[model samples]
Target: MLTSSHCAIEIVAMAALRQKQAFEGELNRIAGTRLTLEAQVNAIETANLNAETMIAMKKGAEALKGIHGNMNINKVDATMDQIREQMDISNEISDAISNPVNMGIDVDDEELKNELEELEQEQLNDRLMGAERAPIEDEDDEEAQLRQLQAEMAM
Candidate 1:
């Protein structure tokens, strides 16, 4: 009952509508893919930032550890120096105490025998009383000990 030209026109219109719908669907799919890719990129960027922050913190901790190690080594070196100084002072004191010439009388000198005997007795008395003479252990006590030893040898 339809004419051929009218039927042909209706079929063309239907085909055009189907092609338009397909194009619109394809555009929607492309837009959805773009959104998913953008979300993935943002997530990756956030992860990279977090990784960088963690690396920086680790480097800072390493620097602090290095500083602490250096400080420990310096402390050990300082303690060793102090011990060496104390040993040197002790050796000097011992050498001075053992010298016969520093004792003010030659070992073979019979002419100064009585004077030497008195000096020896005075030194013994000083050793016994020195600790009780100082009320406090102060720098003055160390100075007094050195002066007293020098005086004993001069006698």
Candidate 2:
């Protein structure tokens, strides 16, 4: 049989072990609760930030729409039209500047008319010499063209 004092001491040691286990279980439960609370707070914070971002994007889109209302498409088209008009005027000026004889300042009207007539006469001679054509009843046209070309070439 065991001694009574030894038995009492064994019982006290068992009680102490049970108390220690209870304390550890309570500490673990408290720590788990604290972690769960921190996770819930973080999740709420993320959701709130997402909602704020969505609202800010919507407001920015609305502001851009308002700004577009003030922008005019017709004004842009009108500006392009003005640019095209200026380009056409500039091209006309370039053509005028490049041709001094056509400007009427260097050559008189009579001289211009004579140069155009001479050019026509040369074209007629080219057509006659470049290709063979059937004989025409109007011999006067050929005689007049030949005389003009020969006279110009002689000079």
Candidate 3:
């Protein structure tokens, strides 16, 4: 039979060993959990970085689109300005041609009148020659005939 004091001592030593083992197991579990948590955190951070990069790229693309749109608008405005300038020039030329006083004319002087008449005749001749040189097309009649031919072909 064992003594009570010896039994108590043996029980105390076993309890201490069990406690130490439990503590070590808990520490290992905590370490594993902490490692897993760190890995998940790193994965999330990488995903966040990727998302941010994509967003920045999207913004850059949008900015490029806006710039392209603005460039198109500017091109249109430039073309309109050119057309307006051409129209203004045409108006100025027409005005100059129509105004006899602007042609350095003294209508009261007979010699100047004769010179103006000669100049006017020359201008009329040039206009006639230009008209004769232009190709004359009866567009409406030609288009109607083309349509009729197309209809006949379809039939």
* TM-score of model 3 vs. true structure: 0.44
Pairs with backbone N, CA or C atoms under 3 Å apart (clashes), candidate 1: none
lDDT of 3 by residue, 1-155 (tens): 89999999999999999999999999999999999999999999999999999999999999999878667777989999999999999999999888777457445688888999999999988887888476576679889899999999999
lDDT of 2 by residue, 39-136 (tens): 99999999999999999999999999998876799988998999999999999999988875744556578998999999999998988898788557
Task: Show model 1 residue runs off by greater than 4 Å.
Answer: 71-155
Order the numbered candidates by lDDT, best leading.
2, 3, 1
The sequence of per-residue lDDT tens digits that candidate 1 reaches over residues 42-149 is 999999999999999999999999978667777989999999999999999999888767556445577578888999999988886876664665668889899999
TM-scores of all models?
A: 0.45, 0.49, 0.44
**What ranges in model 2 sit over 4 Å off?**
71-105, 108-155
Candidate 2: pairs in clash: none
- How many pairs of residues collide in each model? 0, 0, 0
How much lDDT does each candidate structure score?
0.91, 0.92, 0.92
